[model samples]
Target: MSKRKPQPPPKTFSVRPKRSLRHTLPFGLLLILILAAFSFTSYESYASLYDADYVGVEVCADCHTIMYDRWKDSPHANMTHQPSPETVVGDFNDSSWMLPPEGQLLPYDDELPAMRTFTEGADFYMALRRPGTADFTSFKIAYVIGYQYRQTYLTLEEGGSLAPPPPAMVYRTARVLPLLEPPREQHPHSRRFVGANDHPQFGVEPVLCPVPHHQLRHSGP
Candidate 1:
């Protein structure tokens, strides 16, 4: 008897599922690695820009050897120094000069000139009359600037420091010297007379390079 041919084995079929992104890759782990790389690079870049402290040239030497080499022997590097026998070139031998009063040239009339004295001893000093007072205050020599032509002296400010440029910078050459809190020297070419400037701005314009490393020049001698 044919017995329905054993029901033809129930006609079964097998199907294979398609692979997806989550199955082929460690999707979460891959995403985490990408984010970590990005964060590490970003942190390094930003951290270097905002740190505003003088870490010194040696600190930068390792990373920027070329720049450090160019700057180390530059005039800016040797521009300023603590006063010593070797650094000071001025004739600070108790020398005295009868400078013009405040902001005028050598008095052709009845004005008494300001008196400046340079003394050298255990410690060098520059004695000059302070403004609004009749007494002369002796300020110790704190620093010396470069000597391309002449040496300039810098004394300590009110707090015994060279910061904020207290009547410090005594330029070596000038016709008139104002013994003011901030001296305004004049270099008027006219030998006959040089009047006091209403808006005096002949010398350094109150700008100071307190930072050891002044702005560097990348090109040109």
Candidate 2:
């Protein structure tokens, strides 16, 4: 019997640990998802501060009909808008006045040539005299802010040579602000203007106007 050449010692076999594709794939996907979410949130936060960039209320009305209907006529809805016959509440017809320069608040004075404000055709205009000289310049009203307790009209800061009229041409500078309360009764000797009056328009003045408190609640993230 030819002794079968000692069958080479049963060939030794070795097994090595293998990495799981399932475990690695899911972890990589989770990392990618987290990165995408972070990028989107950061961009949204940066775009909200610009007022001119604000998507007008009309854009928001599509999905929120009921709320939009309620807000359409609400004071907050009219907070700021272009000047128009329908939107203007002031009695421009019978109430044109030569208002004192923006800073000279209160009782219409007789000392200087007051600034004249009234409606002309379709637009409102203010005839303002240049300080020291007699150059009367007329400015058109551009925007109106607030309508409930007070309605303040604003002129553009630098739309033209008449812009930034005098003191400063800041966005909120008031061209005219109608008083909510009727004129106060005048007393002899103590000549104080009755009712509400236009305050000074400042370039960097800090003025706080009233807004509906509930409107803030409606704003969502």
Candidate 3:
């Protein structure tokens, strides 16, 4: 007996069948979960409403008592208030000044004639004669705060309507401002009669309206 050939171990069929649903289900579910997560994050990132309705500053004041109190006392809070007698500095009396002589006609060929001499003792005066006629005049007064070399004055005319000055006699200047300056460019100085012909048309033009209380909206960085 050829050392009884060791009976070869019965061929044990151990081939592992390919895992179908078991392997694919988890991978498919994981891919789907990842896709959903990415979609949710993307939607949150880009979707936002800009320029939404605001609650207003008064509402904010309710929570910030101290800050609101300080803001209330600031000049911004009193910007549009009526000027009381105590706060007003100009002479309220009906002071008048003449722009040109009674019969003198301004030369239309040249620029409108400016006031040669204003009436003495008048609290208010006219800087330039009216457009066509010297007899028809407007009132002007020097500004208390002069910047840009241009005096800001209250014009008698408002958008082509003739409105008289307030009884308080609050007025501004009508001086042309400089547009360009030496080395550092400066605005033109205020002039009585600024026109298109003027170098920069500073005061004559309507571009330089001053905004005093614009900073009120800015709280901080």
Candidate 4:
């Protein structure tokens, strides 16, 4: 009979919980990638700033062929060089002349002091007298500056090698030479005399490119 209808078997059901790892795993991976990229960039910047050296014009030419070509023709590139036949434009034909002391022309009425500039083979020399005395000191031409318009000669500064310039530079010297011209020699029309600037400090002087004074034009002969 309809005895208590057998209690319907209780329905069985299970509820599944949502996973947190799915969302968190992707977020953690993204954070890790960003950190790795930042660390790599920082290392590169540090290495470049502190570990670079002056590699000279040849190294520059490798990457900047066009720029190097233009600079090669400019006066700055030829401003200074080791003594050589082609680099030297001045006459070094074993000639010597007496220069008026300080600021005067030749043929002085009094026994004014005079300095001598002479050449031995290819080397140039300047003989200077100490002030208030007849002591003379001669300096040899160690380097030359200016070849196109005007030129100045430099002698190796005493104790120059003891203190080298910063590693970034290719060359450095504490000495400077004023423009000197022998009286008998026909100097370049464009050349002018400059005061001797002897720096007491040992270092490299700042160098700047000279502005071209005149341009050259070529024509058929």
Please list the C-alpha lDDT of all candidates, in the order they appear.
Answer: 0.49, 0.48, 0.38, 0.48
Expressed as tens digits, the lDDT of each residue in 1-221 for candidate 4 is 65776778889999887768987899899999999999887765644653464345666788899987887787656666766778766544443333334444334412433445557776766565543455656767666666655565556555441111111011123112223234524222233222123321111233432222322222232
TM-score of each: 0.39, 0.42, 0.28, 0.42
- Number of clashes recorded per candidate: 0, 2, 19, 0
lDDT-best of 3 and 4: 4
Name the lDDT value of residue 18 in candidate 1: 89
Best by lDDT: 1
Candidate 4 worst ten-residue window by lDDT: 162-171
* Candidate 4 residue 26 C-alpha distance from true site, Å: 30
Scored by lDDT, model 3 comes in at 0.38
Cα displacement (Å) at residue 174, model 3: 14
What digit string (tens of lDDT, one per residue) describes model 2 on residues 1-221? 66756656677789876869986999999999999999887774443565436565677678999887887776555565567887666555533345446545544344455455568788976566654454667767776555554464455543221111221111222334322222323211122211111222211122344221111111123
Error of 4 at 68 (Å): 1.1
Candidate 1: residue 180 Cα off by (Å): 7.2
Q: Clashing pairs in model 1?
A: none
Model 3 bad stretches (over 4 Å): 1-48, 77-221
The segments of candidate 1 whose C-alpha lies over 4 angstroms from its true place after superposition are 1-73, 100-113, 120-122, 130-134, 158-160, 163-221
Q: Return the lDDT, model 1, position 144.
A: 69
